[model samples]
Target: MTYDAVTEQDPLGMRGIEFIEYLSPHPDDLGAVFTRLGFRLVARHRSRAVSLYRQGDMNIIINADDIALSSRTVQDEGDQISAIAIRVANANQAYHHCIQQGAWAVPTRADVMELKIPGIRGPGDSTLYLVDHQHKVSIYDVDFEYVSDDHNPPALIGGLKFFGVVQYINPESTAEWIRFHARMMGFRALPPQTRFGILPQGTILQSPHGHFYLQLIEPVGDALFDAEWYEQLARLAFGTPDVPATVRILRERGVSFEDNEFAHPDTQGAVTAGLSFGINFEIVRCPATPESP
Candidate 1:
């Protein structure tokens, strides 16, 4: 199959993050945290220990399957983001394009009851899935069974949209990671002075489509670099039209925010204290764009 060459000007037509998958031994605990953050469980996997949650256009998957692909890591880490599925114009083309540009192809071994999605190995043991845009059908439709009759679309709280995902890397791996995304995934790094949300000390890369971003952060102040601190998809950020309003809604739902000197609820942004399994979220006040709808 032919593949497009990744370049600063030309990309593989990646649209946005399709869904973020979290691996957890205690799905209920993580599910509660998700509910507090305004997500509702909508579907359960047909043959695996997994469930799907939805809010607005965002999809979150909780995988508790002992036999799942990343089960061992989940067992070790308690709960962490294990995979990120990206929406693309064509999954095969995008996968091939990345492979040609030096990405390591993740082997597919779908069971009889599952659909094989194309992907590549990402930082650490995380997998980056490539999925085609499907209007009438979804990959979830094939692997998951709907548990809710509410056919209505998910509602957003204060107009929230995916801003980006933060990745924690080794101290000196910033340039290497930047080059990987730039050469293989068509990501362009932002200037050093440019910052986002409460945490501002990371290298940010904008996707080719400009729908979302990827932030690469390194450990600070003589922190020991262990295998655990090498590279991992750390946190996910959501953009809101009003930070205070969004914080209020989440607070009413039992979510707590950090109120310290460095990061607090304000017109700029707010961050939640680390929830169960070291998962935290950021709420940033950004003007709602037409593409967000």
Candidate 2:
């Protein structure tokens, strides 16, 4: 029997997100902000100044090493999304597939990582790492040493999942990005009516795996010509069964949310106050993901 379009179009064997990495000089400060969002310091890289934070199924890496910033694509000075690791069937195959499809290859450095993970350049100064997870070895076991014995750190807000990321694109690049994702990763652009979270003003691309989304948002009218506007991964969004309850618990944990027209705690979703590095978290009104029968 033939499979559906999503399965038939998935050339890279894309699974789901493994981890999102951030490049921050002041990792301690970033860690504090993450802690406020209920992430616990779980692991530290064996060879680099990178610490892994975890909450539920989400994994975040904070890379603070100068060597890492120098060798890889760290063009900007401020803290931003450096890389996002995507689990695939075969890291080598996935990496080569992207390169064959006109994707820019990021050279693998033996000194930086124990596992020779292959990757390509993504939007802004970010790389998308293709990891061969559980093919033979788990990437974490090879690269990280557990600092916290708690393997499964429950989120403060129950049923939280790494829903997706919000990417700010340069003006008039929304369609360009949509086509890029469709061609490269088998992502389908949902109908315009399809939306998630409080600030719903963008094109949403659904992954072939149906595990996450990538919302591409272009600059607004005034910011369209703003000299400072640049394309970058802007926000990390999580999905929960209840939005107000999630907001309340996070508030008790000392997390302050932006109470403005764009975002509020009482809405279907709430956007957390941004950190100094421009990173923000959005809690959407998506239900607890259903399990297969």
TM-score of each: 0.90, 0.90
How much is the lDDT of residue 252 in candidate 2?
A: 89
Over 206-261, each residue of candidate 2 has an lDDT whose tens digit, in order, gives 87656678999888889877876778887888888788888888888888899976
Candidate 2 deviates by what RMSD?
2.8
Query: What tens digits encode model 1's per-residue C-alpha lDDT throughout 189-272?
Result: 988887777778788898765667888988887555354565788788998878888899888888899998777888878899
lDDT of 1 at 31: 97
Cα RMSD of all models vs. native, in order, equals: 3.3, 2.8
In order, how many clashes per candidate?
0, 0
Q: Give the Å error, residue 144, model 2.
A: 1.9
